[model samples]
Target: MKRTRINKYGIVACAILLSLSKVTLAVDNVTPISIPMVANAQVFADFTDDIPAVLNYFTSSTKDEIIDFYNQSFGESIFQEKNESALR
Candidate 1:
C-alpha cells in the first residue's frame, strides 16, 4: 500500500540522519593522571578551611535576611579563625 511505502521511507531517512549526526571524538596522546581516592576530598577540605573567614563574613553579613539557616541555627561552625583554634 502507499501508506506502507511512506512509512518505510520515513524510517530509512530517520536512520540515515541519526547515523550522520554523530561525530567521533579525537583525543591527543596525553596520559591521564590517576588521583588517590581521598585526594579530591582532602583538597576540598583544605580549600574550605582556607576560606572560612571569607565564608563567615558573607554568612554574618546576610543573617537578617536569611531565616532558619543551618549554619546559624544549629550553631555548627565550619573553618576556624586560626590554625590554633582548629587544634582545640
Candidate 2:
C-alpha cells in the first residue's frame, strides 16, 4: 500500500510538472510584436492576447496624416486601400 501511494504521488507530480512545462513553453513561443499608434489617438479598445491582435482607436488626424504616420513608422508605404488602409 505504501508503494502504491508513492507511485500515485510520483505520477501526479510528473503530470503537474509536464503541465507547467507546457504552459511555460507556450508563453515563450508567443513572440510579442510592437504596434505603432497614432499620436494623440483615443484608444477605445485593445485586444492584444487574441491571435492577430486588434486595436481600435480614433484620431482627429486626417486619413492621409494617419497613413503618413504609419508609413514613416514602418519605413514603408504599407497602408493601402486594398487592405482597407490598415497595417497588416
Candidate 3:
C-alpha cells in the first residue's frame, strides 16, 4: 500500500510538470506585435509585453501631421475630434 501511494504521487508530480512545461512553451511561442512609431519622436516609455502595447512619445509635429502618419501606417481611416484626439 505504501508503494502504491508513492507511485501515485510520482505520477501526479509528472503530470503537473508536463502541464507547466506546456504553458511555458505556449508563452515562449507568442509572437509580438509590430508597433508603428512616429518619425523623430522622443520616446518616453514603451510597454510591449502588455496585451495591447503602449507607447508614449513626444513630437514637435502638428496634430494633423501625427494623425496622417498613423492613418498611413495603419492603413485605416481616422478622424480627428474637436477635443484634439484622433480615433480610428
Q: Which candidate has the top score in TM-score? A: 3
What's the count of clashing pairs in each model shown? 0, 0, 0
Candidate 3, 2-63: lDDT as tens digits: 55436888899999999999999988977766678777899898776656888888889887
lDDT tens per residue, model 1, 1-88 = 3554367888899998776665322223333443222211323222222223222122332433343354455465665354567457
lDDT of 2 at 56: 81
Question: How do these models rank on lDDT, best leading?
Answer: 3, 2, 1
- C-alpha positional error of residue 68 in candidate 1 after TM-score superposition, expressed in Å: 70
Question: Each candidate's TM vs. the true structure?
Answer: 0.20, 0.56, 0.66
When superposed on Cα atoms, how far off is each prediction in RMSD? 15.9, 5.3, 4.5
What TM-score does candidate 2 reach?
Answer: 0.56
Better of 1 and 3 by TM-score: 3
Better candidate by lDDT, 1 or 3: 3
Q: Which whole-number lDDT from 0 to 100 does residue 59 have in model 2?
A: 88
lDDT of each: 0.40, 0.79, 0.80
**Which residue ranges in model 1 land beyond 4 Å of their true spot?**
1-6, 24-88
TM-score, candidate number 3: 0.66
